[model samples]
Structure formats: structure tokens, C-alpha cells
Target: MADTQTMPVALVTGAGRGIGRSVASRLSAAGYRVALTARSVEDLAGTAAECPGETLVLPGDITDPAFVDQLYADIEAAWGAVSVLVANAGAGVSASVVRTTDEEWQRMLDLNLTAPFRCLRRALPAMVERRHGRVVVIASVAAKIGEPYISAYTASKHGVLGLVRSAAAEVATKGVTVNAVCPGYVDTPMTDATVRGIVEKTGRSEQEARSALASKQPIGRLITRDEVADAVLLCVTNGAITGQGINVDGGAVPS
Candidate 1:
């Protein structure tokens, strides 16, 4: 159990669904007051309802700078200070480099790369002043291993890792640690959409399509949302883990 007296407040972006929702729920259960942010108010509310500690629902797009500023302000006013910031808002686009449009590429960078950087920039001042903080960015396996039809996503995640490494170095001596968790093919809404795409493209049943995708991993199954959440929890709770992109990929990439 987290110590209630020192129980820190956590702000998680993209907390409406998938790994984000799992992370928020786990943290709240561990006695952290959690602030949940996402674009869908209903989904955010549902996530908040599952949490044990005080939950603040702030629905907005993390890619929007103005909205992100407002989110921080709201959290600050209510929570007094943010001890953990989870940059978990990101999306994937299916397109090869040639087929990917400028808009698609920009959108991927905005969400997966720029959004995390912006949040870190805004959160760092307060964290530094307090001489303590934890920042965890939910990156992807594609960051290290390039995947076909996900060039934008791969590039964006790679950029995210770069940001993590740089930030970790900058704040290492200041009582803050920055790290990333790279998850492969988790059973989430994003994976559902990918399964649907495979079905549409190959005339396969949904189950078959999902199976094919899962088979790509050595474990022959998709990682669960809770599994990914466990990894994020490790990064946030462990003080010595910094500047590391811990892979939760079911041995998809042998290290």
C-alpha cells in the first residue's frame, strides 16, 4: 500500500481507455490521488469510477497545447502538486512512408512525440522546485523495431524515447527520474482496430485476424492492458529506474 501521508498526486493523459485506464486504476488503488484526462468525457468518467482514491476527470486532447495548459492548471488548483505525470496519450496510423500523408505524419508526431515533450516542459518547473517527480512516457516496441505500415508511429515513438533520455539526464541529479515503457501489441482498442483492418484487408474472420497478429509475438498472444499497466507502475514506483525504455513485448524483440 502507498503511504497516505506521502501519497503523491498523479496526472495521467489518455486515461479513458487501454493501458492508460489500467495505469490510472492501479495507481489509485495504490493510494495515489489520480487526475484522468482524455478526449471522451464518458470514458474518462468510467475510468474515474473504477479508481479508489480521489479522481479528477479532465477531458481534452493532449495534442492541443492550450487544452494541456488548462489541464495542468486544473490539477494544480485541485491537487496542490503533481508528483507523477504519465504521458500516455498517443495514436498509430497505418500507412507506409510513401502512402502516409503529411497530415497523418504530423498528427502522429503531435500526439506521440510533441505532446509528451510539451507536458514535460510544463511539469518540470514545479517538479524541479519541489526536487522530486516521476515522469513515465508510454512508448512502443515500434520505437526500437521498425514495423511496416506504421512508419509514423515508429518515428514518433523513437522521438519520445529521445525526449525521455534527454530529460532523464537533465533531471537525474535533481531528485526526478524519467523513463519509458515500450509495449507491444496489447489487447486494447487500438489492437481491436488493427484486427478489424486485417479482417477487411485479408477477408479473414476477426478472430483469425487477431490470432495472426498475436502469433507475431513469441508468446503467440497479445499482452494484456493490465500487464502494460504493471510495467508503468514499476517505472513510476521504482526510484532507480531512469532513462530506460523497459520493453513489455512478450519477447517480440530479443534483447
Candidate 2:
């Protein structure tokens, strides 16, 4: 674990909004000096303003390997080292397996799976050398269960889980722990997009579309962004917790 006395540096991808923004806020409140990253620096401003401690707003596309390298370089230059990494940036698409195009598959995989891989690849060496680090991947319930019309998203999320588990095993004895938080039907801009899609496709009211997603969970309501961030904080603070996919789906996949 990182030193509790000194403020740790937390790098959060997609810190622009939603769960990522919530995670950044939570970590900042917990005494972390957060480094926020997204496409445009302006996207991270809201999160940065909410942070209690220091913040670095980095703008870049993680799918580009060069950007991934440069992101770490800038963080290292500014904060020296990052003690925690929240791989939260992702993209989603709704399309049946037969209708999913190759471009869609690649885009989803590149941002959702490969980008996290790139971040971890850069992060592990420093963490391993220091013998202290926390890793949390913001995956989804889709990783554990299959849903129609989102084969690419499901596959990418599944890969995220695999990456978390395998990376945790590799660093198990090295003092770094990796874990994943799987959220179900989160109430966010992304959920709104899903709702809009449902409304367009099925001619359902927005409320009906929302309820359709909520009904999948046993709790019959959408999970909040902060709820998922809380789960990530559990892994971040507890050394005993590692290689686990903590679900915030209200029993939606029950994994």
C-alpha cells in the first residue's frame, strides 16, 4: 500500500464525467492528488474543480499508444509517480452480432480493452519497483453476462476482467493489487444515451426505456456513479482485496 501520510497521486482516465468523475472526486476527498485525463482538458475541468487536493488535467486519446506514453511522462514529470490508476475510459455501441461492423468492434476494443492494457503496461513497472500500487478497472456487468445487440461491448468488457485477473496474479507477490468494478445500468450520460437508443428503436417513452434497464437488476433501479466509485475505493484502500470483480449492479449478474 502507498504511504497513507503523504497524498498519493491517482491517475484517472476519462475523468471528464460520470463514474470516472465520481472516482476522481472520491479519491481527491480521500487525500489523493489526482491527475485527470480525457480528450480535451476542458472536459476535466468540472472534476478538477470538485477535487479537494491538487489536480493535473491531461488531454489526450488513450487509444493512441503515443498518447499513452506521453501521459505517463507528463504525470511522472509533474507528480514523480502515480500510486493509483483508475482505468475508467471506455466506449459502447449497441448492435447485434450480425449487424456489428468490423470498425465498431475495433473501436470498442481499442478504447475499452487495449487502452487499459496500455495504461497498465506503463504503470506496472514503476509500481512493481516501488512495491506499492493500486489498480482498479471500471468494467461492467456486461463483462460477466451476455446481452443482445452489444457483442463488441460485451467482448471488450470481458477482456477487461481477464486483464484485471491476470495482472493481479502477476503482481500478487510484488505488492501491487489489481481489481475491477462491474456496474450495472448506471445512471449517467451513457445510460441516457442507452435510453435514447431504446426510445428510438422501440418507440418507448424515456421513462419506460429507463425502467427496462432497471428491471434487469434485482433492486429494480439504476446504480449511481458514486456507488461504483465507492467499490473502487474499497480495493484501493484494502491490501487484502485483490484480483476481484466487485459488482455494483444490485444483483444484476450476481458476480
Per TM-score, the best of the predicted structures is: 2
Each prediction's Cα RMSD?
1.7, 2.2
Instruction: Evaluate model 2: give its TM-score.
Output: 0.97
Q: Which portions of model 2 miss their true places by more than 4 Å?
A: 1-5
Cα deviation of 179, candidate 1, in Å? 0.7
Q: How many pairs collide in each candidate, listed in order?
A: 0, 0
Q: Which stretches of candidate 1 lie over 4 Å from their true place?
A: 1-6
Q: Cα lDDT of all candidates, in order? A: 0.91, 0.93
TM-score of each: 0.96, 0.97
Local error of candidate 1 at 14, Å?
Answer: 0.5
